[model samples]
Target: MARASVSPAPPRVSAPDLPRHLKRVEPARGADLLQATLHLSGDVDLAHSSLEQCLLTADAERVDLTGATVLDVAAKDLRIASMSLRNAGIRRLRITGGRIGTLDLSGSRLDELEIRDVRIDYLTFGGAKGSDILIADSTIRTLDLPQAEITRMAFVACRSDEVDPRGLRAKDVDLRGLDAEMFTDANGLRGTTLTTFQIQKLAPAIAAGLGIQIKD
Candidate 1:
């Protein structure tokens, strides 16, 4: 894990009290983004430019931006409520630290996406297509994996809100450091793709699928 070189540190605050709707504007071009720290109080818009090591601390609101781009933006140790990325042409976007309420990734494409040391409530990968999706040391509320294709994926030290059978879809899926409830649907369970605890959690669903009734 590489440390961010942009801003020294974000503004430290105790929780937040914001309205339901909030918006703020910040330009990515010529904003000293190389080592710049942005203290966002409400919704933030960071569109356009080459931002490397830029830190954004928002009030857990939706981050809306489009058309702007970046080369290697390392966002670490920041709290964001939600993020709305549409028509963004970004590459090598690494998200680390902080918790997002909802991450709506619709109509956005990326390369080499890595998420580590973050806590998110709802992660909607719907209509999102990318390569090399890796999630590690994170807490996910509900993972909606539909239409999002990945060549390589890994889930390490990760916890989910619910064991959604439809929450998983991948060509090469790696499940390690996971809980058993991640796979409760017997029919949707893949082959040889679970750990000991996971197997124990899905045993009842598997038995029920096999028409076996336990005599309590």
Candidate 2:
């Protein structure tokens, strides 16, 4: 009496033609490099790639990065000057220890976006619509969220000075950090979190949202 046996399936591989100076990329359907310098042209979609340390500097029109998981991807030294992300979907994005200079994410959507230990000079999340955006332990110079609609956003342990929210509309915005004085509100500060000392930094125009009169 004999029995039948079965073999396991081998791993899937799609090798790429790497450059001599720069390494080649054999990117998976939703998985990619851990650390590499990538140069792209046209629409680049590395969605759901668990990128560790990536250096991406491109002038592409639409970089389709949706539903991607970014861990420890440092863009702190990226000097794109001014870049735009249009109609791109960003979710579950985790950034740590990076330098971002002038990033404009208008007309984009973010879901569960988490940023930490980063220093951004000029960042604008304007005209963006999404939820659960957490920015913690970061230092930003100028952040403009004007005309942006956010849901369940949290800014924890962040230090900033110039935060412009001319037409900012948020739901459940949390500002729990040492430097929460930089935040100003025109619409209001309802469903927001802050300490008593942090609330003292708001001006008459900004404090109107919280129904508090500032003494000049």
Predicted model with the maximum TM-score: 1
Report the lDDT of model 1 for residue 50.
Answer: 45
Stretches > 4 Å off in candidate 2: 1-80, 178-181, 184-188, 206-216
Assess the local accuracy of residue 47 in candidate 1 as a C-alpha lDDT between 0 and 100.
49
Error of 2 at 125 (Å): 1.0
Off-target runs (Cα >4 Å) in candidate 1 are: 1-25, 28-39, 46-60, 66-70, 163-169, 180-192, 206-216
In the range 40-72, model 1's lDDT, one tens digit per residue, is 546666644445544455564656555445445
Listed in order, each prediction's TM-score against the native is 0.66, 0.61
Measured by C-alpha RMSD in angstroms, how accurate is candidate 1? 10.5
- lDDT string for model 2 (1-216, tens) is 686532111112111222334454644436767656665445556655555455455544444444455443333333344444444565444555656666666767766666667777877887888676767788888888888887777676788777777677766666655374456564545445667666656655555766787675
lDDT (0 to 1) per candidate: 0.59, 0.59
Clashes of 2: 4
